[model samples]
Target chain A: MEASIRTGEKETGRKKVLISALLFMGLGHLLHLKQYLKGLFYAACEVLLLVFLPKIITGIGNLRTLGEAQPHLPIRERANSMFMLIDGIILLAVIFIFIIIYIISVRSALAAYDQTSSAGAKKTKQGLNKAFPILGLAPGVGLVVFFVIVPLIFSASVAFTNYSSPGHIPPNNTVDWVGFDNFVTLFGGDATWAGALGRVALWTVVWAALATATCYFGGMLMAVVLKESNLRIAPLFRMVFILPYAVPSVISMLVWQNLLNGTFGTLNRTLRTLGLISSPIPWLGDPWLAKFMVVLINLWAGFPYFMLLTLGSMTAIAQDIYEAALIDGANKFQVFRKVTFPIVLYQTAPLIIMSFTHNINNFGAIFFLTGGGPMVKDSTLTSAGGTDILVTWIYKLTVNLLKYNYASVLAVMIFVVLAPLAIINLRRTRSFREGEL
Target chain B: MQPKTTKVNIYTIIVLLFLTVSSLLVLYPLVYVVSAAFSPGNSIASLNIIPFGDGTTFKHFDHLFKNTNYLIWFRNTFVIAAATSICTVFIASLSAYVFSRFRFTLKKPMMMAMLILQIFPSFVGMVAIYVLLLRIGGLDTLWGLVLVYLAGNTPYNTWMVKSYLDTIPRSLDEAAIIDGASHFTTYLRIILPVAKPILIFLAIASFTAPWMDFIFPKLVLRSAHKQTLALGLFSFVTDKKNEFTNFAAGSLLVALPFILFFLASQKLLIESLGFSTVKE
Candidate 1:
């Protein structure tokens, strides 16, 4: 926001405007002997951007060639160009932002000149006095820039290259710009990447949907059972049930992973001791069982969250709605369906959507519990664990298999898939709306 | 009007029984894990889901304290968590203060960016982060981990803290500023104290995150000495030797603080959860 300080109540003369238009953008402010700090700030910005242009242009030039011409060049030179290309993109974004600020600053300076020249006597401080908000924001913005922004741009750029498998990593074998070859490989049904992606995509969707739906309805049902009935200790039961959620998810998932661990697991041991089973089940080693166990563990870890959420809202439902329904002779089920459930659903729908998208990227459920495994051996696919969602697949591709480019492609794809959800979630949520801050 | 003629039905009995059975089922794994921690044996090879099965021992815990770098990992996790918490609370509250008080051009877009920028699962950036940290010589360190935690916790934490601040009336700010107090001083002396509850919650949340985080630390910190409590305990079970009892002991130690905190903050937890759904 631009704050213009006025000294008087009259407009500035054309001479100051001409000086500002001709000498420099903000020179008119100094010509009027008004808004000196604002004018100086604008002047400094123009000079800085002007000075900074060449490096950005150099980066852009390097980005254009992008080392393709010098393919036969040494690894060091090739990687240098790649660095230049990526850094160029980030620089361009920065320059774009700077341009926006420059325009705002210059506009504010001109406006300040007009006002201050007219007012003539009583002047107020402007430019630096209001920089406090920005100063407050500086640390968080700096952190976000380095951690989230830079890494994101870097990852998105990787999807355009061939930085996969053994030979293409940097230094040992300089990663190169492949120009959407990775995307083509991923989506073009190449036996290696496509088969795994296809299976993984199906399982990912199924897992996300099943995990979200089951947890939501499961929690809703549990809450209904506990709350609808004349239960005195419902809060006690609810707290006990939510123990799974209150516990750190990583710990719970790991505990469950071992609890269902086929041979030495308590599940098997207890079942056997009870004479319910003669042999151990391959709870986590079989593909189907592992997938099932993944969902089961997620539900155990996830439902209590929904239960707690639904129960809280449930209690807040106005008694009038229930009374009105019951006065019309509606049965308990009808009263719930028409009144109670809808109100609760309205309250929880956004959360359910958020939970669905959250479950889509749920790394811990599969990562800690199953590690996206019992490996899918149907094809020669490398890292497609039986239960690997898009997220964990991205993980396995990067950490375990060194398929950085392929993983980056999957990462971007996951973004494309989830962006809509994010947008909707933001649009619907209280946090992202107007007047929120 | 009360339905005083109500009779107990099978549905009620079934629901009651269902709740109890499900409660036990849910508690089953937790009970087993706790039992294993105290049970004498390492593996569930000989133990049942009961306390002091075959005479439990504190030997595994003693070994963890004496042999392994468990204490160091605990210290490391605490340092990282506390640093992350304090830094996140301070930084986020500062930003939140700015956001809550000031109106600006980029404010809307910045909020949107905060929301959408986090859409991509963070693991996507893992390799890039790995490379970035490697290039900057930030790998295998706690400071780098803390930095990442701060970045990761910023968006919603800022929003949350801001919302908390938004509830404080603007009249206070105006009065303080009119009383010759700068915006910065008013924020420090008045707004922050008013928003103490949310700040505390945000700090505790940020603290607990790194204490239990597995992925980022697992990637960034490679050395055994640099491993977090999460990576350390995960390796306890994931190792070829499979130190199950030790993993249990480590996990119990790891969970005790959080569970205690959760219990202490139960009202705040429920209140926050309630606010999220009903806030609309």
Candidate 2:
């Protein structure tokens, strides 16, 4: 680069060579176009990137133990004692980012060389024009990868390790890879885990399906009744219904929690005062009632969403379909069954599926209302309450019990169970599938 | 338009009565809570079905205002919610711009990554976030909660907004580029105005998040002073029972703004949901 003659358009062959040489960072600028300073900077970047390669490998290696050995090691021997896992992830992420940077550098340097040779100019400064996308994408992507993706990877890794209660906590205690022991414990005949998993998993499915069904059909029934009866004040009815949905769910649920509280809740107190019952009912402290209350409270918050969704889709259904059905001698019920119901269902099927999935992870309502209540007295479960869904159960396990390994295993299990349903629901929708870009 | 084949009879009367009862049932909680807020007595037991039970007074509201850090919690919630809204909109807009407009090398993979990231529920990564916050000393801080809230919302919001943006004609972008504007300029000037509805919708949706959110804020914020409205109000009832009236009053006060804000944005919110519903 230093001694070469200035290259120009006639050096298209040199530009092609430089483009190919872009694989080695500044080689394009150095050998094809004489730009010594820029070439050296690119070379330094390449060297620095190479320096991060071993760090990535070591990070992956250290992922197995998560640096538990640091606690057992001598003071002088402790390496990355704090945030060994974090350090590893940061190193690996830096390596990943540097690779991307390397690709950009190589491509940009090659473009500069190509333009220098194309325009017969010895120097080219493409300037900040190319920096726009990078600048725009940096903050969003950085925060997402750091805060979201990194934690996800940690969870994924922890799923394979023994980072649970007792002997496996970090810092004071060391956590090591226990292979599929947690999964085995969960899946095997371990009474506490398996019983809890089976019970909660079954309820989760029932809750999700029932929540969606009750909300959905209830909404549909309401819409049909209003549409059929020719209610002039339908908007007013609709407004009243939508109030529960519009209010932030946490406030509504918490309000309901107090309303339904067993001892002194307004419902129990009012009922007792009215001589409806001889004694106060433990509405949330009883298992069956707690489950019923979870669904019932969730319904109060959930049904309106379906009502609106059904109403919107119902508006899209052609009145002509009903007219056609009517002309075919279809009764009112027949018209609804054959015409209105199917069209509404077809349009809102994806949403119904999504709502089910949402209800599965509908953490706030269940967690806030019951805190997964009615702890079973003689059950084989630990940390989980009767009304607890898988999500809240996982929460109790992690935060309350410090069963990180079991929680992570449960997390992975949840991902396995729900991710497919979610992906299928997402892809089944027309809008997303039809979107080309 | 011609025939009235079905006659109204007992079923019609039953239907009307049933509908009225259902509506009343839906309105029951609000009426009861509103009454409790204004109830003269200082306990949940005294919360009668009547609208202004015993006598109407503002003492609970007064207690909430004077004796507690309700204002600080309100201030913190507003600050967090507002910051989250603005940040989510701005960041999601930019990310969605690249996603919608420009085709890059990682475009497909990035899209897939975001989609997959979104599908995996947030609790799967909950522990990692807690650990990360602890390591970075983000625990018990408002900014830390904001950061978490922003990250948690980014993928889904970005994808939703991007799908909406994709519906805009590419010809607009082409014309702007032909007019010698940068891509960012076109995105900022030409595209943003058109995307105003969804942006406002996103802002409102996110603005309401921290106000109502219990779990994440509960996890990230620990101290009394750092508590958001959700956590502070939760603490009132999560323990012993004497603060029931106070909790009801606080919930009423907290919900007043939200109820108003929500009613105002009700149509817009539904419209946005319907719009994003198209994306599954």
Candidate 3:
């Protein structure tokens, strides 16, 4: 960067060599570009990172080892491998971000140097205007990195570890990297784990599909019906229907759980009193029945939002479409099939897919309603039941059974399966496709 | 306008009949909850089939407030929910403004990342969050819970609000800047006030999310004193306890205001969803 002008073209070549050789991030800016503040900030970051280099290295090393096994120490005094793993994750994330900053600094400095056709004629000022986006984004991005990304990395790391309960909980015993053992166990290595996983995974797909389809079509039907009915009290009906969606899901699920309780429940009591049946039907007490009921109850709680959404999209369709279809000698059903339904579907397909992913992870519907109950006939999976989707299964495994490794595997699976669907949804969005406003 | 049909068609009649039955099904549990909250006995079995036919009492309400940690739970949940909402809006709006108005090196990738981040289930990181909270002393602390909520709050809400903000012409900000307004000032006085509808939707959404979230609170908050509405109320109705009436009473207290909030904001919520979806 401090290369004397032996020749103008040759000087540029020499400066590039010196800057890359020195590996000083801001040297080009300091010596050639004369952007002092920019230079200072870049140099400061490099120095700060250098200051913390050993700690960062130790973090990566700790993540690799989890923690030193202290068999001689008592349980309470032992190293917590979980804590070490998380700390390592945080450090790694910090390093990753620092790398991005480093690259930006070096690139900007080089770009500025290259633009200096005349020396010191165009020094880049670090204006507040240029700093606005970075300043504005810092706090939110910081929260996300620590709170979201670090935790995500930790969970993903747990999937590769032996970090479950009883035998593997930290402080009692240090967790070791198992590396796809859990994945293998669930995927096919262990019969019981594999069978339970296959059944649950299949049911998860079925549940999400059924839940999404039923709610969508059901809500669509209601919206169309309400639109066609021309009923004066339609607004009242809309309000009533919206109750399920408006009420908090936990409360709604709890109320439904009690109402559907096998014994002493109002529904069964009424049925019994009316001599509808001699035996109380095990609405939630039977496995298949519980699966059926979960979808049905979800339909009740979910439809209104779709109904509203459908209605909104419906309004956006110009009145002329319906009139044109009618003029073309189409019946009401034909008109809807040809025009209304397709339009609404086109407009709301993203949301419908979103709902599918939502249902896939809809823990409350299964968790609070049946608590993933009415265990399957041959299920060796103590944490998962017939109604349990992957998300709820993960929850039970984590909270109840302390099967953190298996739970994280399910979490990873859910991410793999669902993230693509979400990405597809994102791709379909106009804002995303167009790239920016 | 065409004159109203003097006679009801069979299709209309059939639809009405169907709506009537479904309405009853929808109303039944709601009616039951209201009845259970007021019924004299602690057990649902003792209540009459017809709502309030068994004669109502205030004992469950009295029990919920007096005998339980209902008030403390309410305070904890309210604090957490409010903080999450306010912080989510502030953080999301600020970043959203940058995303909407600025063209920068990392802008596209950051926006895309925001969109993608919204889709990953936050609880997928349950073990990590638990460990992280443990390390940071956030476990059982309301601020800790708020921090977790705020983290999850950023990505989607930022994208949603950014899209909303994008619709507002940059001409206003430019006009203000031309009039000697700073970027932050233009955002504070010009953009935010104009973007009230979306901001309100974001606030209400983030607020209501934590109220019904049983899982994270269950993981984070261990003490009864730090329990949220979902956690504390859940305790009364777990397998070991059968305080259904108290749960019902407590839920009604939570649900009634929530229902009102939803009703009042239903249009906004629907409109926001509609806007986002129909953008294509």
Alpha carbon lDDT of residue A64, candidate 1? 63
TM-score for predicted model 3 compared with the true structure? 0.94
lDDT of 2 by residue, A1-437 (tens): 63254444346665565565566877776776676666777788888877766876777677545664656676565543225666677667777877787776676666665676557785444434455677778888988898889888778777777777776666665567678888888886586678888888899999999899999988888877766777678667777787887777877887788788887788887787789998989989999999998888788888888777777667666678878888899998888888888878877887787788788889987988888887885233487888998899888888888888788887787788887886785676444577752
Which parts of model 1 are misplaced by more than 4 Å? Answer: A1-58, A61-86, A126-128, A326-331, A378-380, A429-437, B1-6, B9-12, B46-51, B163-169
As a whole number from 0 to 100, the lDDT of residue A247 in candidate 1 is: 82
Task: Give the higher-DockQ candidate: 2 or 3.
Answer: 3
Ranking by DockQ: 3, 1, 2
Error of 2 at A428 (Å): 2.8
Mark the 10 consecutive residues where model 2 chain A has the least summed lDDT: A1-10
Give each model's clash number: 5, 0, 0
DockQ of each: 0.61, 0.59, 0.69
Clashing pairs in 2: none
Per-model fnat list: 0.67, 0.57, 0.77
Query: At residue A349, what lDDT does model 2 achieve?
Result: 82
**What is the per-residue lDDT of model 2 for residues B1-280, given as tens digits with 9 covering 90 to 100?**
5434466666677878988999988988888778877787766666675667578888989989999999999999999999999999999999998888776667777777787777667757887888789988999999999999898888888887887787889998889888888877888898888889888889888898778877788788888788888888877776565566787788888777766776676566555555554444
Decide which is better by lDDT, 1 or 3.
Answer: 3
What CA RMSD would you report for each candidate?
A: 4.1, 4.2, 2.8
For model 2, the superposed segments whose C-alpha errors exceed 4 Å read A1-23, A29-64, A68-82, A107-126, A319-329, A377-381, A429-437, B1-6, B9-11, B49-51, B278-280
Q: What tens-digit string does per-residue lDDT give for candidate 3 at A162-187?
A: 99888999888999999889998888
Clash pairs, model 1 backbone: A7-A119, A8-A119, A8-A120, A9-A119, A10-A118
Predicted chain B of candidate 1, TM-score versus the true chain B: 0.90
